[model samples]
Target: MSTKIAACAGAATLAAALAAPAFAGPAYTNDTGGSFRWYGQFNPSFQSFDDGQEDFNRLTDNAASNSRIGFWLEQAYGENTLRFNFETAFGFRSSDGVNQLSTGDNVSWDRTNIRHVDFQFDTARYGRFSAGQGSMATDGITGADFSGTGLGASNAVADSAGGYAFRTSAGALSGVDIGDAFSDLDGGRLGRVRYDTPELAGFTLSTSYGTDVLKDANDRESYDIAVRWANEDAAGFALDSGIGASWTEETGKADQRDISGSFAVLHKATGLSLNLAAGERDIAGTYAYAKLGYKADLIAAGSTAFSVDYYDGSDMVTAGDSAESWGVAAVQKIDALNVETYLAYRDYSYADTSAATYQDANVILAGARWKF
Candidate 1:
């Protein structure tokens, strides 16, 4: 193995060896049956990148799931309940934010790091209503995955080393980044008001309208609707799926529309799973992703999971462009320590009919996540 790979493996081993015990902190309760709790997780990774012409390595906060903290409060009123949530990231240097030209660490807290600040009310008979700076109705609709290795490999292939520029066949920078070519067209969080219907026969409906709240430069308004279903059978098979459509428009600007969905299935008896996702944008073209995974109690401490995934996208950054990526990952869960150690390898390639041919890029990531 290369020195970089060896270093990453050693770090992962050390992290697992020193894993701390799980702790959720104290949950305070009131006489009225109200409760409050705080929680968070730290996700750090060692990333090594080879962009055809050069190589770069860094220790960074995993963009797959950045370090974050949050608080939840809940109260019951007969058959109904009210809840509040506040969450934010730590604003650390991110794996995907560094590139050949900008390798220096950049870290600072900002409003953009705020993930959720919202209120929700749930009714047993009616449904659920939410208002806040949080997830839109379609958020994560295209990312459903039963694979335990999702922390390292998923539909979001760009999260691994997005900022790295692709090199042309002539060994020159193409001025285009990986993130521009490979997009999942997935929904994202925003300031919004949403409603979700009560589950009926394992299916539920949701909708939302929202706009940018933390960023001052955005003027678009967004709307979306989604449907989700989940079920488990006595035969030890489980399935989860969701589909959604969203639209965003800004005065005088061309409106954007997208449709996306994902499904995952697991066979408990065989510890085998399958995940599939697909999406299309009115202007950006389309993409599809798939992952095959297996999990088993290979160790006494916890389960070991392995997966391989692939992504293919077309016309993401510009018309006539194609992007493809593939990866393999493994994760080891330490149940007693609330920690997950992982190692992943991914390869990316892009092509454009209107531009010079580009060389492929490869990335290696090793990390650990600890939740409390």
Candidate 2:
């Protein structure tokens, strides 16, 4: 009888502790003063593509903005915040055959893979420190662009069906294909330890050391350092800029180093935005990209943006050859519905070093993104 009475008392105390003021709202807080909540985006898109051969329609996962679900936890201790985030994403694609939802087949969530799992500690005076599988310091800094069509303009195309073969004007298969000379060298998410200094005078510095950028078994370390700056208004224009560099040690291979930077400005008064970025890697050559975009009040509660971009890569292949790509993209942002629809057309041409021939590839892509 005494033992039963003690158990009842403990249960009541636990219930009371959960009802504390810190446990308010949808998120739940435990006795340890930590709160946890779930957050994620379900982004699905449909696309019609001209894969240089037959025109086919596909309902695909947006390559640029992948679908993900995750949860976050945080606890405040003194002047510091302790946080944790775990995120995973689906790898649904039309070419997955059995997993394509539109084929009346049972979709497989088997490939829902882990993307980020990290713990962070942040202090106002000491900045932030993070560890685990997450973004490196140099990630996304070089390819930063204010253009609304990031899903189509930059390396995001690789997430889609842009890798399909190209057909020549004569309806014959061209030797070259889209995404062959994609000049994307930004250090992506990796298992690493990273640190960032507090923003001072609109500038922040960061550095990260990782096992490998691609998580490959190279048994070498990757080091990245980056600096970023942002100003709401630089004189009369809004400015965002950053520069980053990375060195990757390759086992039994030549060590690789990459340098990249980007600058973007937007004139709010005129709705004109310009973006410029460049990246270079030793032995891999160099590439530069520029984009000009405009946002106008042509739609009610929405803005339309038209953008044109060009890429030039010198010695992208052999010593004397080069590759070039140009494209046009347009986006309509409906703020009321929180949706953005886009259309893009791109043309690629490259020097065929093996055959000493020049070939071209072209594609047209369209999609819409709804944020929830």
Which candidate gets the maximum lDDT versus the true structure?
1
Worst 10 residues of 2 by lDDT: 95-104
- Candidate 2 lDDT over 103-153, as tens digits, reads 432244542256788899999899999998888899988666766667557
What's the true lDDT of residue 187 in model 1? 87
In model 1, which range of ten residues has the least summed lDDT? 14-23
Prediction 2 TM-score vs. true: 0.80
lDDT, candidate 2, residue 24? 18
Per-residue lDDT for 267 in model 1?
94
Give the number of the best model, judged by TM-score.
Answer: 1
lDDT (CA) per prediction = 0.90, 0.68
**What's model 2's overall lDDT?**
0.68
